[model samples]
Target: MEAVLYAQERSKETRATLNSLRENGNIPAILYGKNVSNVPISVEKLDFKKQFNEIGKNGIFTIDVDGKRQQAIVRNYEVDPITREIIHIDFLAVNSLSVITADVRIVLVNDAEGVKDGGVLQQSMFDLSVTTNVNRFPDAIEVDVTHLQVGETITVGKIRQQYPFEINHENDEVIASILPPRQEEEISTGEEQEPGIPENLEGREE
Candidate 1:
């Protein structure tokens, strides 16, 4: 989880730098620490894109700011609405050994038996935030979908603990469910195409 990141010192304070950085494939960011004051910094967009994709938005990061290393985590990120281009980023300083809470992405594994039986799989929660030491945090939560049956609900409490962390979400919150799949394929083929039928449902490509 601890990886070295390099950044440049910037102080122009103009929002135009943000645009300029984007054009150069760099991220406009600020580094702030409880022990250190806020400092303007810029990082290569390509480097950040790779790290973010692998570690996610909340994982621990070791940033080298002006040759001084600091332990931090991503606090916020802004992306273009239409183009989905990253714009702004914020980093919060933290001790590498300190305990912190972060939301980890949930990955559904295997094809559910219920879905194979003409049932729809609903992922209610995409991520589960937890409290744990920085060194002990997990990259993601794995929820097995193989045993789920139609109309069966998987709650946060049902997850097998593979890591030593405290789950902060409600135990009763359904993370995934098996519902009856839509039987509209037969009807749609026979009828004219309707307006406003999206290509994907719930942001899934299917």
Candidate 2:
């Protein structure tokens, strides 16, 4: 929940972030805050890489811009889709206690039992949208499926949490389920294979 600080960009002199930052071996970015004006700046790519690695996408870093530091969060980051190199970035000024809505990953636990018992474990939701104070966001929600038998389902209401936020999904919505495995052999036996392929091949002279 710690917040990062950023430097104010003073001049608009810099253009062509790719070429300038490459020739100078730096990354170009702009910093703006709700309370502060936009400023253009650049930082060493290596240094940015180090900080990003330490904190990951959820991390906050103090960006030094022309010596005047202000509160900021990574609003957006531009990366090369193919090479995934950092290209451009936009920083937004953030307050420490602001409420934010974000997507949190949903993880399923003890799911292999379903597959072992001729049941299929179907995960219908990957990420769940949640609203919470910025500092108290949950990393993920873990659902225990060890006791879930075939035809049983786990819904959003079944998840219990009293910390920092609330789940946005409906109570009746199925997060995951254990369904009876499809009986391919039984289903195939119900249908007769058409005689088209065999009928065509039998008359081929080649």
Candidate 3:
């Protein structure tokens, strides 16, 4: 999806100036790419968040700087660790034929068969790095896990076979997997104790 964001050229980039812009509900950003010179600008915080929600990080959009419009994509952003508020943004100008590298979110579709059988479903990778034409970029990649069974896994190679884009990962990289169900162990005292993997598996991020 494509969106248009309105911004105004920023004349001052001092710390105080940037803080002032943020205080005024604007985010300071820079737009640059290839042959384009870096242009410092500011956009309304609410407007940027709205458009960003519509078009994900990989989605191409247009940035209207004053009266000039340029096709661009969100390259990166900085957020305040304390407030979790976006502080700065980096916009990369691009054309239709431009090839870009981006991280596309991985979405698991449907309930896995193993999960239905009391097995634990674990997603190892939440996103994937890909290089593709700007026009062919995807917001997210959906992996069907409906048929995944216990001890079975979906790998990067399997995903690559379904998508035409170039994935910047090894073919053997595991995306998602189903582990055997938790087993209960009988202690010497004849009490049932939880065993096997913990309910909250290690290395799994929320």
TM-score of each model, in listed order: 0.76, 0.71, 0.87
In angstroms, the error of model 1 at 111 is 3.1
RMSD of each: 12.4, 5.4, 11.7
Best by TM-score: 3
Q: Which candidate do you rate higher for TM-score, 1 or 3?
A: 3
Top-lDDT candidate index: 3
- 76-104, model 2: which lDDT tens digit per residue? 88887997888777876556876667677
lDDT of every model, 2 decimals? 0.84, 0.70, 0.92
Per-residue alpha-carbon lDDT of candidate 1 for residues 1-206, written as tens digits (9 for 90 to 100): 45678998898877787678779888889898677799899999889888877776667788998898988888888888999987878988889667878888899999999999999999999988889887777778888999899989999878736557899977788999999778664444466656875666547765
Worst 10 residues of 2 by lDDT: 1-10
Which 10 consecutive residues of model 3 have the lowest summed lDDT?
186-195
RMSD in Å for model 3: 11.7
lDDT of 1: 0.84
Give the higher-TM-score candidate: 2 or 3.
3
